[model samples]
Target: MSQSVHMSVLLDEVLTALGDIKDKLVVDGTFGAGGYTRAFLEHGARVIGFDRDARVKPYVDAVSAEFPDSFQWINRPFSEMAEGLADVGVEAVDAVVLDIGVSSMQLDEAERGFSFMRDGPLDMRMSIDGRSAADIVNEDSAEDIAHVIWLYGEERKSRGIAAAIVRRRAEQKFERTLDLAEVVERALGGRRGAPVHPATRTFQGLRIAVNDELGELERALEVSEAVIKTGGVLAVVTFHSLEDRIVKNFFAERCGKLPSGSRYAPEVKAANDPTYELVTHKAQGPSDAELARNPRSRSAKLRAGRRTAAATWSEQTVSGKPSTNKVRS
Candidate 1:
């Protein structure tokens, strides 16, 4: 497959992790290009896919025609999968697979403003509606922008970039992707020895904030816990550390593995039952062949788990709010 396309990252690992989904109902949480869903359908599983992007309808329509009664597409965010699926008489699914982060298609289409590589309108709304990147850069205070950059992108020079953005926007609002990118790059001292583009982190932070990606992932994990049947499987592929960390921590929490608090604190059993068992003890990375085939999959990590008979932790799935500005100490 051409690397230019949305080549499914860790497709083999995901299929292996899912074991046998034949004749089972599976949920593709992020059906960007329908890679995972198509694979599941070919494996004899009925698929219910979810995506906020309406542009994916044509691609999904073709797959739906092939599968006929075996496939269904829900044009909604994965966070609302539980409620949305319920409306269509899908109470639970046997497996849930999510491929997280900005899609290849979104990045390639400069009009979406997801990539800093090409100049485009500064509109990075995942759902095609809501607060945009331009809104944040133009309206939010420098402090707020810095907080988002530091929290989402883990950029050390977030303050400098935010300050520069505020200064530049005062003259003319950042209406284009290249305008913001250039400002951020200049703030970071023209890249110097940086491995990636200087504006990559800034663009990533803006995109995450504009789409509320972290919040969506956090809420979606809870929804997966609620909607997946006992013995069901959950396979997630995340592109970066921030996304991987959430999945790792969520799996740890659900498996009854308590975090090591201070030495002063004693270990106590969880009040609720453990809802998931570890499928892969640790996250799986793309293989050498996959790397050669698609360099973009370099940072991808796949983590999978199996649901237990224990009740869902409906009230307390995550530690705090979904869209947290929590800076890791």
Candidate 2:
């Protein structure tokens, strides 16, 4: 197969965390251009790769042809891996690795509508089904739109942006990426020489809400706990603070690092034995060499854990106090 142009961030660190996986089962939860899956196969590991984007089929075909016996591809979201794995007669895997958020392939293709830098249909659905970003902006109420932008994008001026969208849509509904991006940019009073684009956060919010990215990540993390064998690894590379926070909290909770209540409040104890031991005390970021090679990886953070022999926690006991502290970039 031809080489992939898409770069897998923190590839060396992820491989190191997984240790020796030769002949072991590993799930590449976000296959993308088959970068990680190819690496795993090269290491002599058997891989089950999952991706929701149909556009990745060509890459999948190439990897399958080369590693016919060792590679398998599932064209569903990684959150459904447990059910997908059961259908393939696999009970558990030795490790599960996820590269979260939108893939570079989607971002680069203007037609995918993932980037404000390029104009395209306002479609950001990862599965190519369900609600599109155009649908949200054109049909949702101003209040609802503001909430989505604020909650998912973390944009401080979400209200003004939402109001601008509503006012503009009243004249003509938004159908193109540039039309909406322009509105958001104007709403924010132009870039004002900011390093990042004015519409970055607004686009991010719409994309997350459209794709249900956070919900999918949460479900995948939970399912992974059940499908990994004892001593198995669960490694995730997050691109932003929101994604990193979820991963950090999940690892902390599973590793028995439950949050202690305030001095006036009672301390909480784990109802079940810890399910994992943290592979790293703190999250790992890209090395200086990697940053120089791929500046896009600057925000990437990798967190991993090794499964313990303890039984998986019940739903009631699985809840963890959401971390109030912001994740350091």
Candidate 3:
């Protein structure tokens, strides 16, 4: 049998924030390969694991048989978790943990089309329901293609890469992962001396676009805050700066810092009482040892918040709602 894939970044810290899980119902929002689920079960936590990828259900099923009545796995996006669990009459949860982004299993499987190192179909949909990356690459207008690459991948040479893609597709459409990777490599003049692959950012961009990852993540955060009970722990392990920023801002706004120039003046009505108590004032990153074990973890950032005992629905509790300043449309 193949060795189990390791989860990237802050795996230990995430579980720690969850507290003793004995009999406490928790939601493993990402459910990618069940790494967090396994740990939660071992700690005697009752878990409802959710993943958009139906393939994970088999593994979850196996675990359920081993620990009957302790685990429930749902093959659907975490965004729908609230409703999925409601069928069984679960209204609120004790904790919700979301490890966002692609899993090691997705990248390792050559047929999954998530990695450039392994040749696969250009499909990058995590749910298998949305349009594939291949569709975007071969059919999107140059401007649209460039926008996805630049906005999601942060690739500086997005225009050049998009132009090359359009030129190549005119002859033959992109059918495989490496086919697009090669074009990105050539346009970027190759990574020659760099340890990272030249196409890393391009692939990241494509996957984000195909999955609409950021938008989903933002929604999940909001929904989680609403559904989790007061004193619940909300932990998120993000693999990129963009993901980290959203988590950071969400918690900061919930904590409700005073507006500038208000320390001496009568407090401006304290807009909203704090919901989550910031667990770590700043975000946490992987340790050096972890970095050595998994280079993919280098970019990972973990931010955690504990729902205050007085926590309330973010918008309902607060008089006004905070705006989600998304970088992309």
Candidate 4:
């Protein structure tokens, strides 16, 4: 994973946070290009790595050749780990590390349609199946499209973009990534002096929607909570605010950091005792040195928690607040 990952952000911070897994088994939840798993293996921990992309098979095979008995690769979404790992005779893991959102490998491959930098089919599924971004653009209602762009991308001009997409698609359906990107840029008034390309947020939103990324992330965190043993570490590295916000709130809720709210809307407290202690009270960013080495990590944020001996929270107790939209830690 490190071979393709090139650099892992907050590498020192994550290793230090996990303490010494040593001989314990660790789950590399995302396995993107293998950065975390490589580090975990090097540190003497057995790794159970998960990923949906078949492109990682070569990297997984290479690691397997070297580590033999210590590494296992599961070609599935990280969200499936709870039941999947249990089925394989593993109930709990020493630590779980998730590097959320699209990987550098995916983004760089124009054929994957994760980026509009080079023209390619608008197919953004991490797996071979599922509805493609082109499908949504060509099939979804403008209002629905607007909702996805607004909610997932947090784009203020989503409605106009959706309208433009609709008008253009009526004449000729979007097929190429750059075609949609150009339409969005025009809809947003040709970028002006913006630092990033005009289509970045829309592409991000589409990718998230196409892959059900937020839902997958929510599930992965919940599953990790169930499978990490007492005193086990759960570290998450998120690239954007959407992922960071959920992680922060989950950590806050699990660590008893959130206060009981108003009488009308009281705080979501755990019926069981607090399940985790904050390994990171606030999100950690890439250090100056890391940023210098890999500028792509500039937006990365890492948050971690150490599980307690107490019981995990029930789903009903966590229903009081919207975990996805809660205040960040």
Best by lDDT: 2
lDDT by residue for model 3 (225-299), tens: 767777778999998777887888778777765444556774333466676788777888888988888888888
Candidates in order, TM-scores: namely 0.92, 0.93, 0.90, 0.91
**Residue 97 of model 3, lDDT score:** 92
lDDT of 1 by residue, 1-329 (tens): 23238788899999999998899999999988788888898999999999999988877887887789998999999999988898899777899999999988789889998889898999988887899999999999999999999999889999999999999998998899988889988998897888899998888888899999999999999889888887889999999999999999889888877655666876555556677899999999999999999989999999999988766775344533222111100
- Report backbone clashes per prediction: 0, 0, 0, 3
How much is the lDDT of residue 196 in candidate 4?
94
Off by over 4 Å in 2: 1-4, 261-268, 315-329
lDDT (C-alpha, whole model) for all candidates:
0.87, 0.89, 0.82, 0.87
RMSD per candidate (Å) reads 6.0, 5.5, 5.4, 5.2
Q: Pick the candidate with the highest TM-score.
A: 2
Per-residue C-alpha lDDT of model 2 across residues 90-155, encoded as one tens digit per residue: 888999999999888888889999989999988988887899999999999999999999999999
RMSD of 3: 5.4
Off by over 4 Å in 4: 1-5, 259-269, 315-329
In the predicted model 2, the residue pairs found to clash are: none
lDDT of 4 by residue, 111-225 (tens): 9988978889999999998899999999999999999999999999999999999999999999999999999999999978998999998999999999999999999988888
Task: Give lDDT: candidate 4, residue 215.
Answer: 97
